[model samples]
Target: MKKILVITLAALLSVFFIDRSYSKHNQAVIQKTLINEIKEHRQEPIVTIDFRKLYDFKWDEVYVFTPGTSLKNIEQTLGFTWLDAKSTGIKNRDDMDLIVFVENNQVAQYIMLPRKYGTLQPMAQKGNFMVKTS
Candidate 1:
């Protein structure tokens, strides 16, 4: 009977040690799916901005959240209107000023992973970060 309890406790503890942030494998799969969706929908990169400038800029504001964060809570987290770093006019190039999604207890970054997931998955489908619903 004690062995059963030990096994159960071990299993529960294992879950806590699991890599919580969306894994690279998971994000890659999602990115691949989204990339295919964009291709099917005829979405192409139309604008080219100096992304390095944004990356180096001392962000005017920054927010970090674990994977599966709700879009509805964003305003509450920021205590103001929802603002994306890409559109903000605040530019100071020393560090990245952006909302960060982390994986493996570290920042998750995919250089070409288009930030238009919300436009592609408006309903916040599975694996999607932003949705237009309450």
Candidate 2:
């Protein structure tokens, strides 16, 4: 009976690990596909943000923002809501707005632009912010 129980437990553990790995793999594939699509067709030019200057955000290296990052995370990181970020003004430019793309209730991508001029800037600039999350 003990041998049978041990064998059953081992089988269950193996199945669980396999399922978890597969799920992670699928998520990664989905993220990669989405990023590739965005890179190929994004309207605004691509610019790499120096995340280090911003608050310390702990996430996977491959993804710009971790999968499942919520509004709470945004508030914590930026000390403001998405709308607030968008409505914020820029020097010598009209109002700025953030174009947020959400997927499954999480932020998938965001792009910032001047209200009148559609130009891309460094992430540190007032009217520039772009990111992709899983």
- Top-scoring candidate (TM-score): 2
Output the lDDT of residue 83, model 2: 54
Candidate 2 residue-wise lDDT, 22-51, digit = tens: 755754554354345445545545434343
Candidate 2's C-alpha lDDT?
0.43
Tens digits of per-residue lDDT, candidate 1, 1-134, equal 99999999999877756753444455456447544554554543432222223243222333433333444554465554444433322233222222343334333443224334322221222223322111
Q: For this target, which candidate reaches the highest lDDT against the unseen true structure?
A: 2
Compared with the true structure, all predictions reach lDDT values of 0.40, 0.43
Candidate 1: Cα lDDT at 120: 20
Q: List the residue pairs that clash in candidate 2.
A: none
Give per-model TM-scores.
Answer: 0.28, 0.36
